[model samples]
Target: MTDTTDTAKCPACPGRRHPRQYLCNTCWRSLPSTTRGRLARRDARAFQRLRELHRALAARTPLAIIRVSR
Candidate 1:
């Protein structure tokens, strides 16, 4: 058996690289955004939720704070 695929060196560090990937898993998600003009998954999800809330408010929907756990 043998393994063959394209690979690239991660600019963050030098070591094992993944196929067809510029950065390793650690280095890839280690930063805020994996690439430019991109938002982190968590951030993107939060923005979506905020947009929904704004839309509801514009539509005259009442919003209340049931609880503030944070």
Candidate 2:
């Protein structure tokens, strides 16, 4: 029998997606910053959520630099 638990495709793209979500990574990443599309307006929260994740990934650790001098 086929595995019925497999996730389904994203509504905006042709990629499998999380069961609880309607968007795949590709769609999430491709979402425009401005709400100019019909789908974008409907999935605004998902787009914003992915945007935050992207931002967090792009952020860097602010480690202090030290120098030892004689």
Best by TM-score: 2
TM-score of 1: 0.34
Residue pairs with clashing backbones, model 1: none
Clashes of each: 0, 0
Candidate 2 residue lDDT tens string, 25-53: 66555544342232234343655644543
- Backbone clash total for model 2 is 0
- Looking at model 2, report the run of 10 residues with the lowest lDDT sum: 61-70
Q: Judged by lDDT against the true structure, how good is candidate 1? A: 0.42
lDDT of 1 by residue, 15-39 (tens): 5457655446765455333221232
Tell how far residue 10 is off in model 2, in angstroms.
1.2
Measure candidate 1: CA RMSD.
15.6
